[model samples]
Target: MDTLSFNHTALTAPNRTVEVGGRRLAYRRFGHGPNLVLCVRFRGTMDSWDPLFLDLLARDFTVNVFDYSGLGLSTGKPSYVKTDMAQDVDDLVTALGLGKVAIAGWSIGGIAAQVFAALHPEKVSHVLAIGTMPPGLMVKPSAPLFLQTAFKPENGIEDQYILFFEPDSARSRAAGDASVARIASRSMVVDAITPPAVMIQSVIESADPTTPFPDPDGRYQAFYRSTDIPVLALSGDHDIMFPVENWYAMNDLWPTLFVVTWPDSGHGPQHQYPELSADLIASFVKNNPRPV
Candidate 1:
């Protein structure tokens, strides 16, 4: 395989499409190394990813980012169920002919990634989850009022700042500003945005898991605890949407899960501290080689 220079400009990266489960799945493949799939955040399109972060990850591994079945340029009906979404990811992986890939999931994508790992353990070598809540856990209503308002779709940039940056720190605010600018640099048009209906449905699906919210049956908890795949859970200490406490809950349930929390950061630590986040991810992968 030939190595290509990491493109700082995400829009310039060539967009490719593949047929998966009778739907057209759009994706961008860049960087070089063992295959690593990136599952994007809630309502995030293929272009919404931060180029700097992607570039950093691409430096060490071949990164694959794509649109969900009905989101962005992809074609099909969008299902909000995490298990179904996980199947979609598996279909795409098989469609692309990738063998034994690693995966990093952000926010809701993290939930889907967990499901994927549980369902198809043989196909996944490692898992990286960021700004995510544990499966079947009901989210506590502890977000600050400002952060709550920020969750609205119309809030836009201000919402991003509230959700992803530490409001009390100037440095954190600046990092948030730069990350947003990098996302805009992708030159995404309105058509590229995920539909409001789809976003709402996805959010609902995330909160209401198949096993039940709060995992009253304990089945969801058992599923994750049973998985022996190497897992790394990353978070921002100041995260508002999915607070740092969420990571603690996950750790409490699965004592073996590795956890990393960045100081003075919020929901999107990978964007706020791209270099550190990327280095941690690379090191984790390096340290935990797949069993032969």
Candidate 2:
């Protein structure tokens, strides 16, 4: 589901840019109904989102995808901040004029979602967090050490793609590299080194999530306790970043949550199994409609 294949003439290209935290945010939207905003994992862009999964989701809810400042079509490099990125979520919500919206995030973006929902529970309807941890990982290093190396830019972004994909077999790695490269090349049009740095900063900051806004100690708990919003915690059966154990720990902390696993998938279940992920989201939204 590459963007190139889309008939640009047929669909209206979403309006881009609105001031959010003094940074120009880049966002694209499709379909219409209840708004759905997808926050990318550390260092990801709207184009990096799986096209197949989005096409499936567009069948039901309106989907809005964007990048954090210093990444993708967004602006500001020196001003990039993790807490600011979290605030960008709310700003975009207001910019879009969405009264209430579902917030879904992956990896560090999940932490951003937690902060966003915590601060503005009234604006968020449901949160779908995929492949993320509660706060600290020094206590729970479920991920393999090799996985840490994957995040390092010296190893190259291709290595991270290999780590995130399912089966991750020799064949999978080869295919994923080719696939990731093509997509990244199209969306990341600006300077070569900038996008990677935006991602690195996000990771370095989140390494100590406790220092950031909303505070780490019981932060996830606070979000769960404070918000009436229903959450769907989804992770891959083979997720290496935030392992299945991390998900269990999170679920144990919040009993009301429902957990779903993609048995054949890895860190990126949505990419590996877009249809299934979309179905899970669609079902959750249907069963747990937000109040007006």
Candidate 3:
């Protein structure tokens, strides 16, 4: 299949690194609407965000995406503890001077979003959590077996998306899956060639799970009871990382929570349905403007 290119107005946003809790973190901005910050999942970079999705959201909101410390362009090695990353997010919010912004996260990014909202509800107007579970990894399974194996630590990131992208399909998922595979494979080779200790340290740090990790379930339950802010939780019916059941649990905790399930997608509704995602998000923002 051939690739098609669409032309549109583009902005080359600048990158900035700021000190957050004694560590440097990198970030970038684009689009032009109310401030919208997107935090990627574990080990994700700004590049991990789908360009098309960002462009669409940018049409309606000023979208900010960045690498947490130890990921992508950010400083330090990867750390699993969500609290540290949450602090990085807090610092990013301060560094960008984005006051009371709508915060969104994917996968583990959602966990960080939860932490940020719980810790600084005053600074967050709304929360959008996608493909994520509550704090303790207590979310139960709804994804298939193949996907479970795909996300395991040993499974090469190169094959991560195949579980949902449908390699046989001729759509963008297949193409994107291939692209990610190539990039991840190359990344693995680089890690293999470089000093393994540095990368290992990052991975170990990420594994610490200091922010609500050991007991995310109980903590999220408490956060739900405590938070008054509106939340929009989106999940893919096929997501292996965090399944639809997690969303159900969240709804049980926060009955008023706005929930959307992309029946045809897994883990990445933004990629599977960019227009729908953008429209829903824009409408969410319009309906729930910040208090004056």
Candidate 4:
């Protein structure tokens, strides 16, 4: 099934495209087992994810990661609207003939994942949200440094340390550096880095999706609450961008939800501990199968 990757790992996987709704979605797929579609963060391309994390996930599942419409390699009217992102996911999945697949998203992409699950419950089996806040209200505000660092045209190891890792912890900082290096170690990069203009618009113009499905009182509350699908959110205890506390406050709200926060870590816990994160995700997906 995988003609591009010889070892079934994300690192060596070649680029591919699938046309959907007039949009050419750029994607890469490797490994074996059930399908897992991953969505990247703000200003992130398909090349943005750490290969260590992706390769680890590939061990247990067929991993699919892609660029959003008009970002990176995807061709379409560029937008950061949550509904448009959800549409991208739905169109790409249907175009690729992937049915009932598990979905994972990081940062703002997590919001896109929630929207997708709420709108297309039949197409999704499990939802894995990494380093993202729950919908509605945030228990605490995000760190100002996040906006400062994210708006940069290019990020170096130091910027990454500030954005994704706990600078106070030498261990966490080192882990962040290693993760960044691994992502750059790719011999072939299929996706383009998102430019500064796109980054600014993506963050500023992003909109949350409203539920078209019914909820309690015949009105919408939280999108995740509208679906019975099992949702797992992975985060760092010290995530400056999206605090894990917000997720805890809404723990009792969602019908089926789980959270995992790694200590001394920041926004990208999956990157800091790729193997452990991947293993936990594999166990979660294997244990929770969507009702047929």
Candidate 5:
């Protein structure tokens, strides 16, 4: 297959909607090659992606970024359970006729990706988890309390600074600003933020102490161990939310996992270093061939 040339202009392309499993899903598909499905972070919309980052990935793969049901323009009840969200992704993939795709997820989306891979192992060629906590591990919040406050729906800019950019690093802050600007260039029209009730429910469900992995081992180690699918885990060294230590812990369990950490970045490493992050993901997929 001929790889599509990276097009910066596509970053501002409009999104379309498709019905999946009786609910409408808002999505944008660009570039061409092997399919790559991106699951967004908590309370994120399809427009939330950084243009430069998406453009880079689009150079080598058909990238599909979509909003979860009930978020953005998608219509349905929101799901708090990671597994349920994963199923939604599966439904969308099936609806689009995207066969055996490479999957990447950020933050809570990473958790959903893992579940999706586990539940539908035959459908995934590879898995990439970014700025995610270890599966089934309920750790204390790595970010400051004020950072949580900054995540309020009305505080979009501040939320980006606190959640995505490294606080003390001017360079990282500038990158965050640039990403926000790039997103803005796509459209001044912003979708309604995910409802606080849904967001709170998701947070509570994800962090519930009594609920770990479904298996007896209390972790997803068995699932990772048994699967031959390549897994790449990436995070920011300075990430205040789900810190790099979380990746380290996950790596400790799955020794075969490929891991990387961006220096001086926070929760959103891709936003801080779009070029490098895109290169890393594209390279990983190229290097790890799917089984014949």
Candidate 6:
């Protein structure tokens, strides 16, 4: 296929579907080169990602964005459990016949990415997490304002800035506006809004203090401490939902992990610095090619 024939962009990419594990999943595949499956955050569809970020990533990778089961255009029972969400990634990769693809996730989606990496190591080449917390107890819990604003029936531009970027920082707020505009350019449909009941379930799961992701026996923590899979997590210093400081607390554990934090920023660093983030991703993958 001629690359020029298709735009391979967030707005222009065609929606595709595939049957897996008795249900159909909705997805879009754009860009070129190795496969990169991205998981969306809570209350988010594949459509919510920043356009500039996707376009920049398309330069070196064939980005695959998908809705979890029963979300967006998909058809099946819905779940917000992080491990179950990771299972969606596994099943989709198997159905697509992709080999050793990089798994990227944002916010709660990043939790699923970490789960996928730890449990299904052979299926993943690397893990890219944006605006998310690492597994286990947080060094600092999420701000109450995050839950208050994030679950609103509708989030205005200001809410977006607070939830995803730094409203206090003029530059971050401007970047938020640009990203919101880019996202708004896409055609909107009613099906994209996750149901309220499901959102509630997600909220509950997100707050569960004893999530088995850490596992009582210490296996998952050990994986982070000693896995060969290269991991990269990006965040803004004051992320209301998942603070960057949590990653800092784990400094001694992850030998192969790299955390990038932007000053005076918030949750959505990729949206704020799309081009630089993409460059970092490409460089990370190039420098740490997964064992073939």
What is candidate 4's lDDT per residue for 127-187, written digit by digit as tens?
9999987766576878889879988888788889888889899999889879988988988
Which digits, one per residue and each the tens of the lDDT, describe model 3 over residues 88-193? 7888999868888889998778888888888888898888887776655545754456534543554454355544443334564665564454344332112112
TM, every model = 0.88, 0.80, 0.78, 0.92, 0.88, 0.93
Model 3 TM-score on a 0 to 1 scale: 0.78
Rank by lDDT (best first): 6, 4, 5, 1, 2, 3
lDDT of 6 by residue, 19-115 (tens): 9888988888888878888999888888789878998898888888899987888878777777778988988898888878999999989989989
Clashing residue pairs found in predicted model 3: 33-62, 78-202, 79-205, 79-206, 80-205, 80-206, 80-207, 81-209, 135-216, 136-216
| Prediction 4 TM-score vs. true | 0.92
Highest TM-score against the true fold, candidate? 6
Cα lDDT computed for each candidate against the true fold? 0.77, 0.67, 0.67, 0.83, 0.77, 0.84
Of the pair 3 and 6, which is ahead by TM-score? 6
Off by over 4 Å in 1: 2-11, 138-151, 188-191, 201-216, 252-255
Task: Single out the weakest 10-residue window by summed lDDT for candidate 1.
Answer: 2-11
Model 4 residue 10 lDDT score: 74
Which ten residues in a row are the worst by lDDT in model 4?
211-220
Writing each residue's lDDT as its tens digit, candidate 2 over 1-292 gives 3253232211233536787667888877775557788887765667666666677787777778777776766776533354666688888899868778889888767777766777788888898888765554423454565456555666565565546765446644554565455455544232224445556765565454443223546665666754568888888776767766766776666645678877755677776667788898999998886655
Error of 3 at 6 (Å): 20
Report RMSD (Å) for each prediction in the order shown: 3.0, 4.6, 6.4, 3.1, 3.1, 2.3
| Backbone clashes in model 5, listed as residue pairs | none
User: Which candidate, 2 or 4, has the higher lDDT?
Assistant: 4
lDDT-wise, the better of 4 and 5 is: 4
